[model samples]
Target: MTHISKYRMKSRVEKRIKDNFLRSILSGGSARRQAILGELLTQTEKIMLAKRLAMIVMLENDFSYYRISKTLKVSTSTLKRLHRHILAGSYRQILTSLTGNRADAIIRFLEKILEFRMPPIAGPGRWKFLDERRK
Candidate 1:
């Protein structure tokens, strides 16, 4: 019967997925990460995904205003604003100011605006805004 055949096919595909997931977990990718990804694939919002990806590209690099603008296909002014935001804003605030909505400067200048005074954490990529939080 067609129903029986479909069930068998689904079972086979699920087995392969389970096997691959087991291997990934054994390699220490984190059980949470594996579980979250394994919960059936789904679609994402294009704009939000693009914004988050752009944020990642900017954060992961020692990028200039012009460089980030070019890479993210946004205007130079917009990139400047994001730079300003990173310095002046908290994590939640930065998330809000995404998409060319905010000024660019060394993070120190932005920190001055926010009156955010915090001690620095030691380590690579420790505190996000170095120019602001670091000596």
Candidate 2:
């Protein structure tokens, strides 16, 4: 059997994201661009993903919103809408593999989520630990 690389897959996904974002800008914010990226972030409508990619692009880039808006020809609102989802941990299931190793896959998924989470919660908060009991 042939092996697939997680790094390669990650690059592909990141490329798609960059292409979609840049295309969204160059094409005057075409509906097609929006649709393509919108679908990848949803997961049975139960999870969120892609916050890191978006943050890296927007924050690291010096381009202003108006410049992006003008370049993509999209309203600031549309870009903001997608940005919100990415930042809010709304997109999901950003990983997949051809192997049968469930444990490795889950660890990768959780890592991706944690990387996006700020000051990522290390301990339970407002939620009871499995060992904790109430009076």
Name the top TM-score candidate. 1
lDDT of 2 at 1: 19
Cα error, residue 33 of model 1, in Å, equals: 14
**Pairs that clash in candidate 1:** 80-103, 80-104, 81-102, 81-103
- Which candidate's lDDT is highest? 1
Candidate 2 positional error at 133, Å = 69
Tens digit of lDDT per residue, candidate 1, span 32-107?
6656555633344444455444653455345566655554466777666656666665355444554343323333
The superposed Cα distance between candidate 1 and the true structure at residue 12, in angstroms, equals 50
Q: What lDDT tens digits, residue by residue, belong to model 2 across residues 34-129? A: 575566445423222333333324422444666545543456776677666756765434322222455345445544543442332566553443
Quote each prediction's TM-score: 0.30, 0.25
Give the RMSD in angstroms, all C-alphas superposed, for model 1. Answer: 15.8
Q: What is the C-alpha lDDT of each candidate?
A: 0.53, 0.48
